[model samples]
Target: MKSETVGSATLETWSVEEVEQAFAANEIVLIDVRTPQEYIFEHIEGALLMPMAFFKAEKLPGQTEKRIVLHCGSGIRSEKMARLAIDAGVTKIAHMDGGFGAWKTAKKPYIGTDMASGAPKRVG
Candidate 1:
């Protein structure tokens, strides 16, 4: 059975905690659907960038078994990219409800390309 609580509704949507747990359990993959700069500025730990502009980037990290969670600064771009991922035959696609901002607000850990402080640093 599905083991995650998303909201007050019966339908469970992916939450920051769920994503974190998935990462901890090594059951999911995080993908940043923002620009390369934004990705370097901030993103979840281990999240690979597939900038929304390059729609095709979705195909690069093509792995079906992994539950793919996509996120952006505010969630909009991630939602769009999630659809693309789904269209590309990725059925286990989801978007961060509130996106990176919410993830930061929840105090979830992240790692930037520059430093390992869990805060956005810089990309090499």
Candidate 2:
């Protein structure tokens, strides 16, 4: 776990390995803060879409017990979202260290558009 100071709040961050472990254990709420088209291109498996364009802190899943982790194509959008979450009174929020690009560069598993139905399909 890593921490970033944003204003008076602290935003925790996780690496790809940590994110993957938490995901496999179902212990985190993974969110992708990118556009629908960007998400359709590729994303970490199990990530929920909550594009920053239409982001509303209140709309985020109210799963207080679970750690909330956000990510984007790179890390910029996720950082912005983290700040918004902090301003919204959310604490201990997190984002992937390098976002989807890093996750892919590390050869981590993901899901993306299916050739046939244009739906999502898991890929390793």
Candidate 3:
């Protein structure tokens, strides 16, 4: 994980492993900043949906309760949203470095769609 000062706020960039570990420990809030269509198809299990188009810092979970980690399809949008949150005066924010693509590349498990049956299933 790496963090930098952004005005009065801090922005953290963490690798997929860091996010996965913390999430498994229930120590951080994982937020998916992707479209509903993308999320409905597949997503990290337990991640909360807050599409980029509708993202708002105030709508984010309190940082005081659990550290929030944002993620998207390929790390682009999530990083944008994290900076936006910081600019909105969120004291601290973070985003997964490579997003869901990296998570899948790393062979991490996620909730993926079963196209044949139109059902959700665990994928690794």
Candidate 4:
């Protein structure tokens, strides 16, 4: 028998710690599925703003090389977005178990943005 270390890049699902590690390593893609307004309020840092409404319409950007973590205000929208991504031939897909809310409750780090009708302002 032989043993080998499983690479972090091979993971399909991610916990808060795992997500944080992935982001820190720049080895995962964070996709935000909430509306622009909601996303502007607060979101995982480095997450790409690809709302669920655009999931089916817009061509998914980025390479399929890394795991994709989808999140929304709640888990619902992100779950739906995950399904869509899977259907669209995205094999590396995951969603925050409780979405952005849980992330906040867990005291995980995230970035906040201005929700006003203008360019988003990044805050921690």
Candidate 5:
């Protein structure tokens, strides 16, 4: 994990592998801050869709036992949101570095769309 400063807040940026492991261990609440369209195309399994356009830091559930991790298409949007969360007085929050793209590059399992069937399919 790497830490980045956004304003006065320090955001923890985690690699895809780290996020994958935490997810597999049920140690994190993975949130996808991408658009609904993007999420419909493909997304990490069990990731909650909280589109950046309408996301509010206050909307995040208080997760004392589990870490709240954010992710997007790339690392950009998620980091932005993480900063917002921190600024909103959320003491603990993390964003996935390199986002879904990196996860795909790492060959992590995710739910993808089937164009013909218009259904969710598992991809690794």
Candidate 6:
């Protein structure tokens, strides 16, 4: 775990492995802070979309006790979202290391949307 101060709030970060394990165990809420188009192209299985362009902390799912893991195409957007979350009084927050890019490079399993059929496609 790593912590940093952004503005008046503090944000925490977790490694991809740690996040993956937690996600598999259903111990955390995975959020994809990317655009709808980006999400339609590809995304982690079970990740909820909360596009940074219109992100609202209240829109974040899970209870305060539940760990909220945020990710983006890369680490940048998620980091920004984390700051926004923290500023909104969300205490249990974490950003995925390297974001979705790292998760994909690691060959971790994911699901992509079929543009034509508008269905989900599971891939690894």
The lDDT values for all models are 0.68, 0.87, 0.94, 0.68, 0.92, 0.86
lDDT of 1 by residue, 21-60 (tens): 8878987778787888877666676887778888673464
Q: Please give, for residues 39-72, the per-residue lDDT of candidate 4 as tens digits.
A: 7677776899987766762366556577667778
> How close is every model to the real structure, measured as TM-score?
0.72, 0.87, 0.97, 0.73, 0.94, 0.85
| lDDT for each residue of candidate 2 in 1-124, tens digit (9 for 90 to 100) | 8997777778987898999999899999999999998987887767899999999987777666788899998888998898898899776689998899889889888987798988878887
Per-residue accuracy of model 3 over 1-124 as CA lDDT, tens digit each: 9999988888999999999999999989999999999999999999999999999888777867789999999999999999999878798999999899999999999999999999999998
Tell me which of candidates 3 and 6 scores higher on TM-score: 3
- Under the 3 Å rule for N, CA and C atoms, how many clashes does model 3 have? 0
Pick the TM-score winner.
3
lDDT, ranked from best to worst: 3, 5, 2, 6, 4, 1
* lDDT for residue 6 in candidate 3, whole number 0-100: 88
| Residue 4 displacement in candidate 4 (angstroms) | 23
Would you list the clashing residue pairs of candidate 2? none
TM-score of 6: 0.85
Candidate 3 colliding pairs: none
Ranking by TM-score: 3, 5, 2, 6, 4, 1
Tell me each candidate's RMSD, in Å, in order. 6.4, 2.0, 0.8, 6.4, 1.3, 2.4
How big is the positional error of residue 4 in model 3, measured in Å on the Cα after superposition? 1.5
- What C-alpha lDDT does candidate 1 achieve relative to the native structure? 0.68
Q: Between 4 and 5, whose lDDT is larger?
A: 5
| Total backbone clashes of candidate 1, pairs 3 or more residues apart or in separate chains | 0
Q: Output the TM-score of candidate 4.
A: 0.73
